[model samples]
Target chain A: MHSLKDRTAIIGVGATPQGKLPGSTQLSLAVDAFKAALDDSGLEKDDIDGLLTFPGTTAPEGPLNYLRVGEALGIDPAFTGSMAMGGGTAGALVQMAAMAVESGHATAVACVFGDAAKTGGSRFNRASGWGDSWGIWGMMGAAANSAVAASRHMALYGTTSEQLAEVAVACRRHASMNPNAVMRDPITIADHQASRFIVEPLHLLDCCLISDGGVCIIVTSAERAKDAKQPRVLISGMGQAYTTRTLEREDWWYVPHQKEALDRAYAMAGLGPQHIDVAQLYDNFTISVLLWLEHAGFCKPGESGPFVEGGRIQLGGELPVNTAGGNLSESYMEGWLHIVEGVRQLRGQGGERQVQGAETCLVTGRGMTLNCSNAMVLTKGEA
Target chain B: MSDHPKPLPEISDETRPFWDGTRNQQLVMQQCARCRHIRYPISRVCPECLEVGHEWVPLSGRGEVYSAIVFHQVYDKAFADDVPYNVSLVQLDEGPRMFSNVVGVPPSQVRVGDRVRVVFDPVTEEVTLPRFTPEDS
Candidate 1:
């Protein structure tokens, strides 16, 4: 694959405070993040010519015009597109931004997603309810789905419930350092075990916290980034994969990968797992982190338990994942905050438990009972 | 037994043997003629090789529980009566993995790599889901 490396860079990244927004509408939050992104890019809205976003997002077309961000933002882009529904759109969209720049189709592109799921029952309430026979057969919620998978992984690999607890514990430790995080109080394995089982093998604490928030990114030609003021993070590698939404997965241990966005992105950028120094993962549930870790080849399949034990994924561990606390401790939306955390790591702006000497970061967006998936690699300043 | 729940999608001329074998209490798999690769979802072509010619094969109904979860919580309020049920992917003796309920068991009895065999439970006249049970069954 012809490398798109250094062809395009994320010049600006922005997000609304992630945790809660009882009064704010979803569109308002998205517009806020869009304006913040424009301000941070030091680019007028008119300079933006291409707009890349999720088709189902709250703001869609209105917010871009509401912010009046295009004037010198070079707003007239040669391309505009939106991803299909879900968090996987975020990282996959970045690759779209790179393709636009590399093909000389557009110089500047924007990607964003925001929602007020807390206002309703959230996407889980939505993804369920299909009235398909799954309901008749007793396959109801994601927690139930994961509890079984988690238990199976444990039963096979000797992955203790305690090891899974460490995943929750380590995330809270990181969240405590991040004021933007929703649940910052550090948790213990005792808490994870003691907590009531929402589904067998998965405690209540193992689930994600829902909140209202917005996230956005500004993509531009890498050449222009040399003259741009803020530090630039190149789009190194990315990948995505999709499976049948309603069908039971063939292997809870091995996710289908032929179309994984991570594979495509990694091949596009020619970088592999070993080069990533920092990672921001979508931990909507504890198993989200574990399975994706094994699926991404960060560890052997079914080994996510030990892969996470002993403070390994903490600030000083082998690979620092979900340093912003993740949906497990942070906000749950499209997992856009994972991108924001990646940007922070690249800019050396992540405070407290920041991954020291972090130059390259990887972020994976997850969704819907292991359905939607994607990954992106961001490298510090012109790598 | 009391009236069982409505069954999943029924096999037609295209999917006949798939649903029928389960009704007769037999385990079956499909192999692509062009590439001889096995596949589920009962499509005309092999997902791996895209070869259209294929045949149905039967097996000992033996396989390992590659991965699974039992739901104490009902996925839907409609399934509330069926609480604490198991849903899982069983990697069959053939290469393809099949999605079915692991029955004749409880939470304690289920584990990955456990030995299991197929059994049929009539959900309706037209449909019978292939469930797994312990080897002793």
Candidate 2:
């Protein structure tokens, strides 16, 4: 048996009301969400013996670290650390928490994330210099990186702007059904096209919201999960892959590593794309979802543009993606919310946006110059 | 001294020679002595063969636009006047890619697969930013 398959389960998932919550510090939001997860799991604060965090990129004070967040939460965890893989951190942290519990390092591990990019006056604009000479050319922000990839996808595969619009429209339509979603007013393909371009091939609508939010998921052994308040969402499979080289590589934009990650995850779960009832793909940009759809083996390479058309990926479609509106519509917790939404869907708690009879879900994340990618397979606990 | 408002590349010991090549109106990169692999954004060890010994070799200064994106919003005030400017990735002839602007045309005119050649802009006394122009331009 795969070491990670069904060894640990997510007992609780909590997300504070997302969007411009003024005066909410990262630490405070993290604590609030942590407490909420504790309440949701019917577990006391004393039950958490491990804490894992993914530091936010745009904290008002400083990027979140485990020591500061752990101290504020008043938990002296036996296993505690933070991972920085950009959007990949949340899924990776959950996997870390699962491994920690499966190895008996801790009874329960809480992976928490909080960001104040919206309230803290972050525009998500900064130059990236990983020993590269990109800043001099005015390449700034995460959007530009993905925009270049979108442009390449369009060039290599004949992907059209209208096809990209379908992603924005679907996410907006799903967001309209989610009351907690920040941008709930429905938008159309025309709206996406009419919106001003942040980067060519990507519009304002295609990019994700910059909002303040916090999310927490508590992981414990499958034995403990059986006694939890909420139904258990088992972590069946987890895989992560990364690109070592960026601009120098010939196929940097193609992101071939993402498929490798998902393949590993699927192999561990003994499942494939045909089994995923819902997906909470990281939507840092609409193109990201398209890439993930292809990478996760839903369709062939360059077929994502067409696969997303005709409402195939929206709620009630063949594979419902971003059931909680994703980062595009749901408040951007930097892929942390994807895990929350995946857990919620598997738990059958997606009040309005539930995928009917959802038994399995695929949650994916990619970040940091579009190099790191991760995928997780979550399934409903046996009845 | 140049009064360039935009962020400039930080020169390091590993990248000094490449910048020096740019200052001399040439596009040069480290070619691994053992593997003959040319590397960009300058590295001490060759990524392919882990070769420490290398020679700075001049490139053909020709390539095609692999991909490009035009920035419509001014994320930084330094680039405020350059809104809608293009930041393109050019795949050079010798098999290295670079982040450079395809100049001598409208940002919208830059397209993938467009043939381009390098041009040096002496942004400062110490730095010369390498940009590209359509070969036929």
Candidate 3:
């Protein structure tokens, strides 16, 4: 099999203001983000030859597809498609763009995401189709689905809520350094504990915000990236894996398959956890960070709680995670912002939250009943 | 003529037998004919052996709480009065996990690893929901 390492690079990234911007439509936000990325890359709108879109859950009646995005942008791409793998879509979309670029199907690809979920009345409190059968018993919401795993993790590993709070605290601390973060207020473990329980083992602060936002990432061949604006951030390695079965699987909550995905990425990169200078682990919930930490081999299984305690995951710690605040405190672009943060960290553009002299970064994404998992290893390119 | 404001399960061709068994006061699951693998959320094909043949076998109705949570926030108004109710994932002895409430006890009292047995709650003339209660109760 041919390796995708360093063949393509991320030339630009852009994000819109997060949190309840009531009047803006998803298409408008998407176009705004695209324009920003275009300017950042010093690439004309005509330069884009591939388009990929991931619609937000709130736009059920009229979701953004590639055709709509192409029509709105006034350009036809040689390669394009919309994706729906939940949070996992962002990383996988970038991977698909890289493949398209490497395979000579397209020169420059744009992966975009836009959502008006917050203002569009997406409370994210409804039960999924699987949860519907048990809805009569009050089984509902993404919180409840994740709470089951959080509860089981606690019972099995003796992981306490305080340890879980460490994740929220670390992310919020990072967000305090970010001007664009939606929730920038620094919070403590006490604040996490005091917050009302959305579900047992998950506090209100433990959950990511339901925000209105958009993010766009531009990918091009390494040769083309060198000619474009901004420092090149190479896609060194990528991997994706998923499980069809859910609660019936014996190791359901543990989700060992995620580790398999990360392992493939590590092998492709010729690096391991020790080589990662910084990380952008997905954090739709606090427990997700713990799972990623363990699955990514940063710490042993069941030890993520202790690993995150005492500011280990905060900036200036041994391993700074989600330095751009993450989905926990950053605007929830699902997992898109995580990738953007990884790109910025590699570009030395993280500003106050920058991990000084950072070279290699790992970005992870998981979604859809906690089944789909993807990992990407990105590295700063030589000038 | 019932007035249950809560959302009810939508019985489809895939899940009809499971509901039919529950209405008749029995807990059943689709067991693969070739591999004898018990599946949940009833499907036509068995994931384990790829065998299309299956049997709606009766379950033991005895299981342990694999995990449980209490909802402090009501997602629906129908559940407003039931705020802080417990929802648990029960791992049946027959090796299938499912979502159901553990009744006959305070929501706070439920714990992981608690042994439970199935109990039927007939919500409407056509539907019966299976719940769990502590073995000791």
- In candidate 2, which residue ranges exceed 4 Å CA deviation? A58-64, B1-4
lDDT of 1 by residue, A1-383 (tens): 57776677888888888765777665666677778887888888777767775533344354353233333233455677555636566777777787887888878777766666676335463223232234434555667556656766777678877888888898898999998888888889898899976666777888887777877888998888777868888877766777653233455334455236666766766776787797787776787788777766788877888889888888888988889888788777567788888888888888897788898887888655566778787888753
Off by over 4 Å in 1: A23-26, A55-77, A123-136, A143-149, A239-252, A256-275, A291-303, A367-373, B1-7, B10-13, B27-29, B55-59
Per candidate, the number of residue pairs that clash is: 33, 0, 0
TM-score of each: 0.84, 0.97, 0.97
lDDT for model 3, please: 0.89
> To one decimal, what is the Cα RMSD in angstroms of model 1 from the true structure?
4.5
Summarize candidate 2's per-residue lDDT along A37-137 as a digit string, tens digits.
Answer: 88999999999999998778654434447888898888999999888887888988998899899888999999998888798887778776476547789
lDDT of 1 by residue, B5-34 (tens): 433664568778877887888867687887
User: Judged by DockQ relative to the true structure, which candidate is superior, 1 or 3?
Assistant: 3
Please give, for residues A138-221, the per-residue lDDT of candidate 3 as tens digits.
888888878988999999999999999999999999999999999998999899999999998799988999889889999999
- C-alpha displacement of B32 in model 1, angstroms? 3.2
Question: Model 2 misses residue A71 by how many Å?
Answer: 1.6
What tens digits encode model 2's per-residue C-alpha lDDT throughout B23-114?
Answer: 99999999999999888768879899998999999999999999989999888788887888999999999999989999899999899999
Worst 10 residues of 3 chain A by lDDT: A125-134
For model 2, state the Cα shift of residue A196 in Å: 0.2
